[model samples]
Target: MQLIKIDKTQNYIINTGTIAGDMEGTSGGPTNPGPLSIYLEEGRIAAITGTKDDPYRFKQPNRQTTFLDLGSLTILPPLADCHVHLALDGLDFATARRRWEQPGELHTQISTQLWDTVRHGILAVRDGGDRPGIALRYRELVASGELTGPVIRASGWALRKPRKYGSFLGRGVPAEMLDSALGQLARHGVDQIKVLVSGVVSFKEYSRVGPVQYTYEELSAIVQGARNLGLGVMAHASSDEAVALAVKAGVNTVEHGYFLSRDTLKLMAEKQVAWIPTVVPVAAQLTSLHPAPNQDNYVIAKTVDRQLAMINEARNLGVTLGVGTDSGASGVRHGYSYRQELALYRQAGLTPEEIIRCATINSARVLGLNWGRIAPGNPAAMIAVSGDPLGDINNLRNIEYVFQPV
Candidate 1:
């Protein structure tokens, strides 16, 4: 369990019998681990050969190459988090509702959080919502090689109806101005558009979600405008009506479908719209207030149970599910929440392979990144855990190595 450093153009061979990527052989069971010699060229997986094949040779001239023999450790495509808040510190959500006042302090905390996230094996992250300029800077830093972190696909603050929803991580705009709002996000270099179709689920009130923020037509305009700008729209929706409207509007992903019915799940599947049922945020509450549950914690515990049931139902319908931790929310730490979401997915009847797909490949597709696969042409981003995650998904928590742009 030590960190290794190498130059940019230096070639390397990672020797591991366990390779998991490209969504291969993952069908609700542990994939058979075999000998794989992952050969790298210019920081990408140039070739992956098994025992029968000759050690993959790079067909071109190469520099000094080193060999890493990680005999039986599990190697997986670096994970992705489909929804997160880079602005929040995950210290009691009720207290830290607003973005930081000091710009310098915010940058320090967020930079550290991003560092922690990448070090923990997350290679790509879709920031669902965050303060303006904060996520943008990290995106720049990652792209420019000034820092290392998961490829950030930030929404750059969400668009919500003014005067009704609180403005903590996003701005409040009128529904009629949805088109303009999408344009603004695109101009901000957002990789995707986040629309607050409804408020977050209320842990305090039973079956209560925040107020609906956008109408179907309004959401349609937002989605259309975002699409025109070549940006995918991620809808923050929890209520059935909100989820339905967002789906009808053709948003790329639904953030929180906590109360969605099986019918709605079918509709989402039929339309090929991805769903990111953020569990750990509320689960964090449950973790904190268990054994002596308050009304809010009780409601959250019940909601998590229902969410798991719905997630199982979603799987049966062949719905595309992306893993989201809603990190930066109370009790959900950065980097750690990825595995928390995976463990919850396992609890929801998903096998280790299925949870890996949800956290890595499925979420990567939602983020539109050229990742989630350990193929020859893909970026050499991956993580090595101490044990076989395919045997027990919880073993993902034991990250031994994280390979990114280092």
Candidate 2:
């Protein structure tokens, strides 16, 4: 498996086994019969037309067109990671933070993580905030072609209440200084605003999440402030109380919503706010490569099960659900943990097609990218896998080629 960067704008006609979704990119819909032809012009899909029996029957190629045939591989929209922390390495938090002070070392570390992310067929990612603003710098590096990585939507640094739990994410701001804080972030060129509405989920105590960080009025003011700056807010909310408050306060997306109630999910649906339930970071506690000596696996397992149930319920309530591996957390690794996260989605009873939709289109929507669906006029960001992901989601692991738009 290798990642191929399609940076140059040239005519390309790629023939593959099948397309995973219909022309509109809806999951579980009729897949185009293969061997199908996908025509790309100027980095956008010009057309996709073919027949199974006669692969090249309707083919018309120009002199400058490049032709490639993938006999038994399936073509689908590339994956996207809705939540991640590029500054942390997931192995040793202290060590990663120390390296942040060394610009050369930090650059090397993040560059490797980006390559790993692309190797896993993920072409875009929305980075959670870090106090040092390292991820934001990397976003600009990638955009300028100085670094080859996913298209990044980076929250420069999270905003948390004074003495809250997000010290590592950003500097704390008092309620009275909310507008000034947002102005600072906007001046730093943040793609979105991240707010820590709550602390975190507990591992020792089942269903025990950290306390809510902001009052409803305070959170509402923060959301409005970000909106006024022409930015969306990504709230780091865990407990049901915090989740409810954030949703009502008009936060754009909820991250790490561990113990959300069904009612809150319904409200999120009504409000059209997407949820990125970062279950992998929590579930990874039970299956860490280096398990803690006194860790309580039972409580962690139960917590994961409950989160999965809510995920299923969220899907049922028509709430937009995005696939997010809180990569770079304690037990989650960049690129590798993505498959684990999707597998957990399957445990939540999401069908393979549904899971694919979440990882592709839904996550793409969260990242504000237009490259998830493989339709005419869509940016040609897709991956070719050896087996049909619609039949079995694990087949996505066998990524043979990635079509990334520079």
Candidate 3:
């Protein structure tokens, strides 16, 4: 990896973990005290000390490299998008496959998506799942430096009960055949396991709660199976029972818990399971893609409002929430929906620092990565924004640039 240094004279390094009144302070900004020294070596932070000018003044290990000055730029650890679909944004699986039928076409699409994510300052992404080969192929390309994108940790394909939610892209086999399916996915080198427990309301079919995809027994089996193989499980559950089952089954993350109850939220907090509300898909479906007709918009709007209410309750109860844009649904677009998620989180009553932490440190922890902080030995995945996001959360949408380890 090539070494690069960004120097700023007047910029303040606000610590998000501190309990300061305002985000900015007197060290340089209006609220928080700033760090005095920050050093990077081999893509990891070598040192970070309190306000002491020239903390590394005595150390003279290497002076052969040059430093790149980024005047007046505030640097922070790279952001993480906890929930996203690399293969299925707006367009369906059939369309994506047709567009990438020829060799290198799929590679190009992956490259564009990855670069777009980096441009938006997202350094790590947890791709829920896609068709078998797509995610694995892209992961290989990214690792080989053949692509410019965030560090990807992907589930090869989701596993759902036959004829259930996302069955097309998931391995919807019988319970008797699940072991074989998991074995196949492991051979394909998946980073995690994705299980679909309930149907999404955004999809026209089964929108109004009817049949859940997996039983508690089935979920437990799959969870145990994945754990035995040393893989984590991410579940797509929207209803109360489904979320409960997923939690009971020992799933690590729950996606789109729209109808989660207060008890369920408490259980999640107790179990330390991370939640990704994915409010964008539900909101976009009602407003942009499938708008309500006639005078019934009010009723439909209330349903969306109810989902947000559940999220708010979860937050108040101390559930670990992460950033997720259920991108690639019929109407949602990838790379842009994340901003909507941030806005929704704020609307659900989270402070600016809380919201940023959800997208950065919290999301990274959910994905089991050690690269979210700017401390020593972490990956040099960092983003620089024009304004302090602690004061205004919307500044996240206006990311200036992103740098990922080469």
Candidate 4:
């Protein structure tokens, strides 16, 4: 206990043993599910159990103890966001672009965004990319304890081929400069690599999309280059052809797979590449742009339905999936967006447990971190809601408070 730097005079215990969420064992496997008590030792969970009526009364040599009764709250793992752009304020394209030009303002906005995200119970975030190394800087700030926020996994700057709409919040690295660009991110110590293979869907032209940025071979080279530097690749792909091409190149995950076909999804499953549907961006945008069932809203709604069906199909076919709200996209607010994403997944046929698992466990897996789940010996990064989130997914919004990096 002294080595862990926990207060030796008092043993801290959190009890009343309300509930145990998804992961539940020391071996990193599931255990019996029920109300459980967790003891805090050295800022980590020393003991966790559901059977005992008096959980805080544990034997400890030469130690005084204090207990925190959880009462009726639900105990669950910390949530993770698989994709985001801290640089964008999630308002509109023009506002987003203007913010980039004002560096001082941009940094302040990032601080606000990070604070809001973590305060909302998101413990870890994978920033897809942002300019001027803001994402990496924020990650450093979090690591150094200068800022109290989530563990940031940054891609530095997303890569793309030279073309229009290619460098929205990322850099477009030419084919010849692929190795050098990857080296730069590696030098900055990025957690992963993001490369754009296609553009965002155009609201004005409902049937079309942003132009394809990289061919299959080009994307493959970027993947290989990043892998050489010990980084996995995630691609921003939305069209059918672009999604197929990205999967063929062996990117680790595909973002916003809006128009993916069954065959392409099967291919992704075969290759073990996960998909982040990012359904809330569209939902948020559609509601913001045109509340009624206007032509644009109708078209986007239809597309959203198709994408949700494909995601449902992906689950049935055993394709791995991670959830993200694409927070910071147009009209997709950060703190509240993830709840919307979870609701959309539930509407698309995922159970509340499954949706919560995607936001916590599966998202962590995609980010390649050991930060989720409530297991003894694991860090006590957890959240307590006002009610059982498993019973009603909407209760996730009722997060009373969160404790993380425990």
Candidate 5:
């Protein structure tokens, strides 16, 4: 088991026991009927050949090709985390925030988390914005090879209302200064626009979330402004009212859509808006290493159950779902918490295939990438797991190799 950075200039042929295709319109079965010989050229999948037709044809060693024969490993599209806060370390928030003043310490912390994230088979992550634009800075570093990490789609700084829930996450954009604020963010070269539609959900109070921060008009203006700049909006919305507002306003994705009603889910389906139900962050509160004494465990557990039920309902109603561990939030660690998020999806009654689809395909779509599939012309960014992920979703945790293109 190793993490291999693929050299695009070199040719390689990997022979694997099974190769799973994207779970799009049909069943998520292996692309080939039997053992597969996959050809990679210049960082793209050149071809896929099944050994059932001619086993010995590609088995012969050649000088020009780097051959790898994975006996039992299964290859599939690499995973993605749609909503993460790279500035937070899932530990003490006070300590992590204080390090923000020290650039050297902050970079060191973020570098370590990025490696942990990629090692867990997550190749891409969408940073859920930080106030100081720390994640945005790291995105450039990763691009220039100064920092080693996943593909980061960063929201430079989130837009929020004055005295709202997300002071630490981003700047407060007043209604009058909305255009000026967006201009500043666009000039900063943000990959997307993050708007705090509502505040955080409550831990002690069941079914209680913070008030919606933006009116429908304000939110719609933000969404349209972002679109004019060629960016998508990832709305930080909770409760049903906020979720509905974001959907009607044309947000690309809704993060932590807790307490969503059936009608809202139906509306999301109708509008084709993706939902990133960050269940792990809430679930982690109940079992955190450093738990808050004032938190109510029963209330948090019930809240988690309700969210999972909504996730199930969202899938049933054909709402696009993506896997997002609110990493850096209290009790949710990067890289490691991804498996926990998928497990929650399973508890929501999603089968292994469905969970994989959300974690890979749907998440990749949210990140504006053409990945999450292995075929001719697709980028050779895939992962090999020790066991069949289709059989048991936990097998994704056993990442044998990460086939990352250089």
Candidate 6:
């Protein structure tokens, strides 16, 4: 085992132990003043203890092979983006899918996006949904290390009502065929299931004031079916009723909850449901000029105001917010949008630490991953930035370095 000892006077001591996944957080702070002893035995921490008399007394067999003087690095847990769409940027949907269909083009596209995200300090990502098999393929590439990017967990295609809501971005199976559709996705090894319950207010044709795609029964069926397969479900909801239905159906996380009512937010807190409020898409819609019918000036202005109000309300109600960006959507660029999300979160009243938590641990928890924390034994997935994120959350936008399990 290899051990690295970080003795921060009284704040904390990180002892990298032998066990591959051993991690410990102590409240007593660092060990007595000494040359923070570090030992390595078989690529894992053998033992780390602080004592003025003999810091290396706990050392086992092997000698220290590498040493990096941690005189200036502020170590913290890696970050995760809970909701992202790998294939949807400002680029057209047909073009993105066409790129994916080409041999190696999909890998290239995902690799670029993933690395871009990593450079921005995101180490783990949970893709909400995309066209069939796109996310699955990217997951394999990332897991295999054939691609250098964030650790990825993905849903197959999103489930949308035929010819409505996310139909263009997902598989639109008839209500009666949802069970079979879910089964097919499970067979394809999707990590989770994504369901589109409502339209977005920013998209004029599919505004929140219009009817939702799935009836409560349909939504319930999708949730129950996905649960039966031991898979979690993430719902794309933008209206009050849509959020309520998704929460009642027990979807693990609500994506883009743009129009959640107070009652729905309360239900989420009560049910312990998580939220991935992707404000980037709405923000982009409000600020960009893409010439789409959905981007009508007046409509965008109204949508932005309403969405911001809803977000503020959700935050006030203490929803378990996770960071996410509909990155692949028009005007929502990949790496930059995450920064936008963090800023938006702050604007919604979250402090720097709270926003970081939302981006890292909360997002990881939403995706059911155990690698968000930076302690002994956790996967060595982490990043290093220039300034203190505690003082300025925007420091995350200026990430200087990244370290993954390469």
Give the TM-score ranking, best first. 5, 2, 1, 4, 3, 6
**Per-residue C-alpha lDDT of model 1 across residues 1-406, encoded as one tens digit per residue:** 3444334678889888677675755433334366778888887888888888888776655588888998888788888888888878776554444436767766777788888887778878888786464776678888787776778888888888886564776777887667777777778788888878888787777779888887777888888888899988888888888898899999999998889988899999999999999998888777664322344667888999999999999999999999888888778888877777888889999988788888888888898977777777887778888787877888888888887745
Rank order (by lDDT, best first)? 5, 2, 1, 4, 3, 6
lDDT of 3: 0.70
Of the candidates numbered 1 and 5, which has the greater TM-score value? 5
Task: Return the clash pairs for model 3, or none.
Answer: 24-30, 24-31, 24-32, 25-31, 25-32, 45-376, 88-328, 89-328, 90-328
Q: Tell me the tens digit of each residue's lDDT in model 5 across 215-309.
A: 99999999999899998999999888999999999999999999989999999999999999999999998888788877999999999999999
**Residues 1-406, candidate 4, lDDT per residue (tens digit)?**
0011234344667654355465524444333344556787655667776654555444564576656676777777778999988877786657767877888887788788887887788888898887666788889888887876788898888887776465666776788888888898899899998888888875545547787887777888888888888899988898888899999999999999888889999999999999998999887766795342333767778778887898789988888889887888878877778888888898899877777778887898998876567766767677877766777889888777577652
Model 5 CA lDDT for position 378: 92
- Candidate lDDT values, in order: 0.80, 0.87, 0.70, 0.77, 0.89, 0.68
TM per model? 0.93, 0.95, 0.86, 0.90, 0.96, 0.84
Q: Which candidate is the best by TM-score?
A: 5
Off by over 4 Å in 5: 25-33, 52-64
Q: Write the per-residue lDDT of candidate 3 for residues 1-406, one digit (tens) a residue.
A: 2212233211122222221121123244323334334555554555555554555432334443334444444566667887777776464546765755665676566677777677777777888887555766787888787776777888888898776667546767789988888888888888888888887653342235545887788889998888888898999898788889899989999998766789999999999999988888767755664453342445446656777787778778888888888766655676777788889888877888778778877888887877656655566566656566777888766565465666
lDDT of 2 by residue, 328-404 (tens): 89988899999999999999999998898899888898888877688877888999998778889999999999988
Error of 5 at 274 (Å): 0.2
Clashes of each: 0, 0, 9, 1, 0, 19
For candidate 4, the per-residue lDDT at 248 reads 96
TM-score of 1: 0.93
